[model samples]
Target: MVDLFGHAGPAQVLERAARSGRLPHAWMLAGPPGIGKATLGYRFGRWLLAGGAEGGLPAGSAPLHLDPGHPTFRRILAGAHADLRALRPNTGEGGVKRVIRVEDSRDAIRFLAMTPAEGGWRFVLVDGAELMRPEAANALLKTLEEPPPRAVLVLTTAAPDRLLPTIRSRVRRLDLAPLAPADLDPLLMRLLPSLSTTERATLGRIAEGSAGQAVALAEGEGLAMQALVDQVLADLAGRRHWHPVAEAVAAKRDGSGFATFMALLRGALSAAVRQAARGQGAAPWLEGRALAEWSTLWDRLGQLAAETDVLSLDRKQAVLTALLWLTPPRR
Candidate 1:
């Protein structure tokens, strides 16, 4: 079983199931994206396969250890484990497909019908279960209604309410919330050893309680990006013309720092707007009409961000151009 870092609720549920031998046939692990629900599911599957006594195995047990090379682990990692199946969107030659079709769900049903190859529980993990189309969801509901013995189905999603009510009712629902700062700090440090305490703290605040997002930001080229955003905002407040701003953004568009820079620019403008709304007072340099104007600019920048898909590189330059307007006039 993987040692899921934080998610005490699901951890307790797993411990209880192991102790009582009353594990549910299917469980829905629902929470915000990037939380550790998938890790928890993998850990539970490992425990089931090992036939080891559940609940508090010695801290050093091999089963608890994550060995990607182990035969069973390898199969799971390769997504070829006869006893396990995962339902996720297919992103093949035709670009990203948004829905998990009924065919895939039927395959899961077929896989579950057979006895386990290892005489253990068969585990199925559906990532983003809410992506299931109506027919696909109905197919899954049949299995949930009369799940096989010694079979475990784990469905994970950031939005569970989108799933069918029938499917939701048949399975145990475990909610995983964002990790606490104390719990996430060590992980962040490990992931970004070069980050100063101050930088890490800033990232944590921006992460908004999501440890996964914080780690991702730390790994990203955020520092350089943040610098670019700071420069742009300063220029806007200084009333610098847009032409020079556009040139600067265009120059860096292809660099390693571009994505991070764009994200930071968006976040900074958002923070400024929030501050303005709360009457927290703008930066010392921003006062009177300048502050009010920038506040409105910030609102428009946010709208642009929502309307534009950040993944589209073509749209990125335009987004940055819009952000340039947020800068104050130069003396």
Candidate 2:
């Protein structure tokens, strides 16, 4: 169970709406990818369908939970529920990225038009709804305009602005912020119980509230590269020779290593900035005017990252540019 942390404020609002019988026809759930936008959508959907854990957890229990053995849970997971419709990426005859085609999305209309099989609420969930093409999105507009009674639509997106403005206007928006480290730690425990405590802590920091991305980063040797980045920053601060850092990234001419290096470096910089802003102050070199220097360094690194990908520029040189931005060599 992916506990929806840092999201209770919005959830409370939604609960109030549901209890008052004024739940909106459409809801836009927007947040960073991998941070449980879709997870929360399903949770909310289950709540609307009254799919709580069987036998219940006593009064004032969490609504987001559903007993896995429950019929509603099984049907929702199996996509066999009469009152629920789900739209996501699925291949359509040689299509790429398994885009949500208009063909698949047309079912929402038919699903909403009919009465609920359970004589209760009906819902349509579009995960990563931003991935839908123009046609698929247009097809959804009519339902948004005149949804049937007891009908609910949930659209989840990492990038809400990519959606049509008309589509954005009709639904109430629920904004999900990233989970704090404290909040994300326990979730990592549940999801990756096999991981050692150190490993989970490392991933919890890098995952930054994203359970899916944490798994990806863990598998991709992100931690190993982050270690290297830490060494490089330590060398820079100690005024030690840093040529080895350059050589390490240069060894991978494929550019992926450089990208990883930049990502870790950017994370460190952002951390330092945040620490400074909290009145704890950053490292000596990162305090006061030096803070401005780090800011400039971040913006420059961002530009180089953009240009390297866009123009296919030399990655080694781009990394070196970042190192120089950190601390130039002796003249």
Candidate 3:
């Protein structure tokens, strides 16, 4: 019901597994962020609660399409469903916690032990399951090892590799690929009607197939940061002053703006390297550079960015240093 796009194959696989009546007690919906892993998990859970058999519907109805007006859908949306439990990381005094705590993980196990109030099936959806702490992962793994009857647990994660190997082995894994740029157009057009066609296309390129990220970028300073990256690249070979741009980027105290700028910077470098490799005309800044030099700069900047985050380095200084590296050596 969340306007899912793509992944029909995965949906059908779920339906087949359900119809076979040997549905796994736990399912891992793995994919990049914002591509609807959580959405699909919820939909499948809703379908199962609504008597999963496709036989009751008219011809060719999607197995997972529950009517929005239905009580099950309404309850899940309102978080009042008696037979369903959904978990995400909790916020603390500092901010949102990076990991799901062990207490919440144990609570989910308790929720599974109870008989379904609906007298049918109970479901637990763990969004961002990879964020579970080590103890939390171990606690959940116990339930996965010996799941309760008529219960299902769905775990959605961007990085499936981070899950404990024992936990990963217990769940049926479904990996969702990112949507194509063209597929993102409808979402961008609908969510960001004021943006021009060209702007949308650029977002499609920079968003890298995550519609959620595309919308978030449009809502934030992403476009402006991308423009700054373009400006820096266009003037990299010249004597133009760049301190103003670095200062402006550093002044973005929210951190997301600076992060977006760095990401766009890396993307630009990647584009230039790809163009050079393909024997196409590279970006203007790459005019006189060796492919290896450009590649090395890209790798170096990437490491610097990671270190800046880890070590809390001065962002302004980092930007200045990156710009200096972008400059070609004077012959």
> In every candidate, how many clashes are there?
12, 0, 0
- Report how far off residue 172 is in candidate 1 (Å): 2.4
lDDT of 3 by residue, 1-331 (tens): 3666777788899878987888889999998888778888988887888777534433246657778787887888888889999989776447956778889999999999899998888899999999998899999887898899999999999999999999999999999988787667887888889999999988878877877888888988888899898888878865466888888788877567668888889988888789778988777678768888888888899898889878888988998888989888888
How high is the lDDT of residue 40 in model 3? 89
lDDT of each: 0.69, 0.76, 0.84
List residue ranges in candidate 2 displaced over 4 A. Answer: 1-6, 51-60, 90-99, 237-243, 250-255, 285-289, 328-331
Which candidate comes out best when scored by TM-score?
Answer: 3
Candidate 1: worst 10 consecutive residues by lDDT?
Answer: 55-64
lDDT string for model 1 (179-247, tens) is 777766666777678888888777766675566777776666555456566666565545354445445
Q: Between the candidate structures 1 and 3, which one is better when assessed by TM-score?
A: 3
Flag clash pairs in model 3. none
TM-score leaderboard ranking: 3, 2, 1
265, model 3: CA deviation in Å? 0.7
Candidate 2 lands at a TM-score of 0.85
- lDDT leader: 3
TM-score preference between candidates 1 and 2, better one: 2
- Cα TM-score per model: 0.71, 0.85, 0.89
